[model samples]
Target: MKRMIAALIVAGALVSLPACGNDDTNTETATRTSNTAESTTVQISSVTSTADLGMIDQAKLAAFVVAFRTAYADLSQDRDDESIQEIVFSSCNAIADGATEQEVTKEIRDLAANDGTEATQSQAEQIYKLVTPACP
Candidate 1:
């Protein structure tokens, strides 16, 4: 059940990702950056608001989200099974046990600003809004 929910949330985020529009610049950059990311592993070191890492650790949280999305995309779209489970587990492990909706919302908002999704910020905002509450 948890996996189902997580997959749905990720699917929704992906669906919403394009709704807000992915510009050529961001697309190109994401493509170029993803090329070198083939062997990189993603993990979420801090999951909750109380964690000393805090949302203030924007790099951690942003990278976590980006990695999570990338892995999720790879699993569903690319159908790659080799390291998907490990990546997903690491992504889930990054979230602390007591994370709150507010903390996650703030994290999403902050990351969205620099993600080149400003033109459709509200859509990204909605995606995270749906994702945070469902976080395990």
Candidate 2:
């Protein structure tokens, strides 16, 4: 899950880079991307044989992943860690950007629906609870 989350953050960072424009938002985006890359490297080295991830504290992210796996075993068993991480981290980012719990839950539920799985509001709330403290 951490791997997935990291991957998503990295991808988002890359995509957020400025395009042929010199502006504060562009500079800010570039700085954010750089920081994200640095964090990802540090995070990857800290993990033992786990997938490289970016943003958030890895240990806490792992705990969230473990709990998520147990809570949604049937839906998550076949899903790769990276993808789950992506979903979780995306939600984490949203939370950081001021999205409400209900909004996050709806987003998570929607993501599950894409996999043909029906995720409960409680499950979504679990994600909010676990990722909130870990989000940087």
Candidate 3:
């Protein structure tokens, strides 16, 4: 009777051990699935018209230009005006690629408006100067 009881206890522990491990694996899988779902939901707005692109406010445009300049600075070694233009145009072209004509027009206009003011241009230039070294 004593031997039988000991064997039953050992058997119970073995069965419970697998349950604990399975619970951990299930938790890990659930976490991974949630993260993947969140990542896939990341949305990039699709522009439908040139007017919609042009409608971007000045503040937004400024931010976009600053972002563009920063991106350009990182991508180029020579930060001349020509280089800046090349980078900017290339970036615009990329945004337009596979996009509708309206979308391309809107993107260009928005970019142009972003640095329309001297203050914004200066800010964009500053960002460009800061990030130029790290560009690919």
Candidate 4:
């Protein structure tokens, strides 16, 4: 199923993120002088941090939201934008943390189910399908 494939892909990507390394670096130099006749030069260097790359792609996230809302208008209409985003991010985080597809599906399902109406695996699958594309 699409859900299973998406979940597996997301899970794999997440599990591998920690093992990846960023070797890109940047260096800058600044010079300053004061009336006291003292001059100072400072050199700063930084490497791209994993945290910088850990975020989900914004465009993809937006697309996912649109797709989700279209697919599940009734469910999405009840939640605000922030709430939906939070759910997607939470699901992505779980995948990154090495949770299996079933685990991720169950988590989102439980969260959805708590909001007055019972949630189904199919709904969870749709959520997972929509969220996986947004993961960084």
Give the winner by lDDT.
2
Which residue ranges in model 4 land beyond 4 Å of their true spot?
1-54
Model 1: per-residue lDDT, tens digit, 5-115? Answer: 565566556534533545876687667555534323222232232333322232233333444445334223433332322222322334455445444444444433332
Candidate 3 is scored at a TM of 0.20
Query: Which window of 10 residues has the lowest lDDT sum in candidate 3?
Result: 43-52
By lDDT, the better pick of 1 and 2 is: 2
lDDT of 2 by residue, 11-81 (tens): 44545445446787778877876787677657555642333235566556655566566556765867767
Q: How close to the true structure is residue 25 of candidate 3, measured as C-alpha lDDT?
A: 90
C-alpha root-mean-square deviation, candidate 2: 13.8
**What are the Cα lDDT values of the candidates?**
0.40, 0.63, 0.38, 0.58
State the lDDT of candidate 3 residue by residue for 1-136, as single tens digits. 3433354455445434434547779688667656754443231113222222322222222233344444433433333443333334433344445555444444434343422322244434443342232222
Every candidate's CA RMSD: 15.2, 13.8, 22.1, 14.0
Model 4 has an lDDT value of: 0.58
TM-score of each: 0.26, 0.56, 0.20, 0.57
